[model samples]
Target chain A: MAAESHPGYGMRSHRSTLLRRLLRYVLLVATALVVAFPIYITVVNALLTPQQIAARPPTLFPLHPHWGAFASAFSTGHLGIFLRNSLIVTVTITLAELVTSALAGYAFAFVRFPFRRTVFFLCIATLMIPMEVTLVPNRETIVALGWFNSFPALIVPFLASGFGTFLFRQAFLGMPGDLRDAAALDGYGHWRFMTRVVLPMNRPVIGAFAVFAFLSAWNQYLWPLVVTETNGVRTVQIGLRQLQALSIDQTNIIFAGTVLAALPIFVILVVFQKQLVRGLTAGALKG
Target chain B: MSDTRRRRRLGEAALGYVFVLPALAVFGVFVFYPLVKTFVLGFYRTPPFPNLPSHFVGLSQYGSVLTSPAFLDSLWRTVLFVLFTVPLGIALGVALALLAHQRLAGIRIFRTIFSSTVATSVAVASVIFYTLLNPEVGLLSYWLGGRGGAGILQSPTLALPAVSVVTIWQNLGFVFILMSAALQSIPDDLMDAARVDGSSMWYRFWHVTLPLLSPTVFFAVVVGTIGSFQAFGQIDLLTQGGPNNHTDVLIYSLYQQAFVFNNTGVAAVMSVLLFAILLLLTAVQFRFFERRVFYGR
Candidate 1:
């Protein structure tokens, strides 16, 4: 019916369809393997011992797994402290952004206020201004505040995001008006309604923003490098750079450090796969 | 009653500002204020530290930075990097998206594998490539050892291309996801209609699907170009502006001047230039390409 339905076309035989599907499957798997092979080898190298790594014509797979690679990476590579620093900065920023964006989003969406359009336009304008343009001045600001080398220095600048606010605002705008009226009838003011209904109901947006915020904060290189003068407050990204500079000879150990640095984000990505896709494609569908 | 209603309205307006204050305060201090300071900083030559006095220099800094051979070279390299990455990145993204869009069993697994690079941070991705491209003990170097028996990244000529390879690989996932989303969004009925009109598969794809995909392609190009322009982590890790400064793109050059060389004024000028380029690129994209972008009715 599918082929015959189209005029001037004959229906495709089932066998051809099956064959086409089989070819697609092969192509897809082959491409996936090719894309994934670098990561596979990286993991394999991370699991190999120093001697095995140095062996000529490098071993493709680790015959005997070296679990000690991770232990060394954490203890010696200083990745443990780096990981802790990354978690602290990421969590602090994510929580603060979630609250601020959600609050601002609710204000923009539900509350009729003076100068709302102007304020919203200003907030959205920040999205077009790349963060790299602000690096020099922000570093100066951090120094003036004496927050340099402190957690606040790493966390405060990114506590609120224009993108997060926009994402949440779009989410809030999609809510039915009747629901807001009904909530108002139930004596739920803006604050109460936001906390009780909007926040809970927009879990997907919250989750998406949370994953995005955390990932951005975690992956931040330039800001953390600029602000943090000491290794004590440095994040995993900066620490990875330090490791690369310091331990070029210890290639296997560096791979171990890489694994440790990337593992949590990988786990988060796997767990929050849908939210990541939604967060990423959210911009694509819009502007 | 009217007075009470007016009071309520005023109360709501006050609450709205109150709600927006936290985000506003952060943006005001960090984003907006910094933007203004960047412009001001461009006009003054400041010492490395904050306490030192800064002298006004007008647009001289911009003129010097624009004419500097180092800046000019890096700008040329950056344009090359954009050329190397954007079109190829778009083409590969579209190809992968088209390939994965087919209906088949276990297709979701393939999608996951293709998109997995999104999980990799720039730092992690660079580290992976650093290990993979190490001449002394890298898999790729051992496999594809060319003249001089050095890694591709170690060679002066091949460094940019090697770094470009890492970027292209890292960016493929993002581009693929965006393209696949655009593809999936195209209604099946339109394609069906084309088929009913006796359009061959190639004809349908070229005329119908390709037109529908221009907006996504355009978006990818704009974002990809901006991203490549600002890309620092890969350049920092992979080449450190290189064996010969061949990989010394704009952002890294700015960073070196600002932080390493303590030339904040030069860096500020470069920042302004970068911003202008991005603005111009975005404008050009919309002005030239917007007409071709098919907005489905």
Candidate 2:
């Protein structure tokens, strides 16, 4: 009697568990769809005509797709130039940030110096003093240097990042001390050890910071807007704005510009999703 | 110590300084010096006229500007934006994290979808929403029951909230990623123990999951508050702080004063005041929330 009851109970619970799992998936799929709705609409509308877009109750999908918006965005919208500029600025800034951050972070983590703690604290303190606070004076400095509407103004102020320094420092400090000792015993100097051993071991952190720096540098709007007066050096973000203003009636063209501006980052996100997540959450989780 | 040993130690210290110099130089020019100059600029009033010299006004402008109705209104609008974005972003993030945290098949795809907005820059996000909020052609406007004629972004009463929605949506992926990470760090045994004790899922979530997640929540709130305080791109792209200055938060106000109106001294003062308010808010959050955060052993 006990054995027979046990089998019946197991089957009932199994059916209920299956039902619960199905319900969970249903809810998850629904939420994911809602969250991703905007991107889907943007992509679909980028392929639609202005007439279709303006249709009452708006076209939900591109039944008949048009690719002219993209071609026009590149040809007339100057999106190609903007994209090249964005790529140049972002890559340069990311590389510079990595070099500066790795060096400073290594010094703080592994080297001993006078007022080391105080200096490290000061570096971290700069994180609190955001760009918004320093905007006016920085702009003056840019103008004073005759770097207005130039790459130097966009690139120079951001070459050093306190956040990057802190991230690298934390990652370096977490490394095993024996690696350093081993490298030293093998007649490795600071530069050699860092190049061959330390940096290679911390690729994950480096990759993480690289993605962050690239994203931020690419996405910059205010500083670029303030500094760059011409389209010669303007980034894609600003270009998208210009496109919108110039073609107020052309919704499809604006969407195409947006798609172009956002595509690179989305690709980056897809490729380096792990590093982005790990790096972003590193601060929060550890704190 | 031997002389060689002393020399080596000194050499190491010098190298340390060398490694740090480039970073410090950049910071000095861009960050530290500008900070001091901003404070100094606060004391001198630049006239709206381009050719006119800036007059030294001491603390008079600070007094007047701080008490001005324009400044007060902008501050209030900023606070309203913070209230609108941070908590709701956090709640939605938690909800998404909870849904995605389940041990279901193909969960990774769902996680990616949920966190994809993190890739969208403020500009991209604004542009996406710009098209979505268009009065005549916008599907969202139609579905959302936006009143006939003007879109949500154009409506004086609805503009700020509309902007806030974009801000929240843009930040959703970040909060989702953070919360999902926090949820993953939680031990499976804790949930199993509660289940064995016949505690319902809600009870376990309330008693166990929430306490463990408080630290991340606190971090998100502080960071979200700071981000909201400095919001600019969306306003510039969408409203330009118009339709009666309803969406003119403090940062936008500072931008107008410094760049548009050429009230450099007033803008400088606004920057200083913003920094103080942010510092105070951070300190207050730490004092109030830090003790309540549970660090599970």
lDDT: which candidate is best? 2
**Proportion of true contacts reproduced by candidate 2:** 0.73
Q: Is the docking of candidate 1 incorrect, acceptable, medium or high quality?
A: medium
Give the 10-residue window scoring lowest on summed lDDT in candidate 1 chain B.
B142-151
Per residue, candidate 1 scores C-alpha lDDT tens digits across A83-202 of 999999999999999999998998999999989999999889888788788889899999999998999999888878899988899999988879999999999988899999999999
Q: What is the DockQ of each candidate?
A: 0.51, 0.48
User: Under CAPRI classification, how is model 2 graded?
Assistant: acceptable
Sliding window of 10 residues with minimal summed lDDT for model 2 chain B? B142-151
lDDT (Cα, tens digit) per residue for candidate 2, span A10-70: 2347878899879988898889888999998989888998888888877887888999999
Q: Rate the local accuracy (lDDT) of all candidates.
A: 0.85, 0.89
State each candidate's chain A TM-score. Answer: 0.91, 0.92
**lDDT value, residue A275 of candidate 1:** 83
Error of 2 at B182 (Å): 0.9
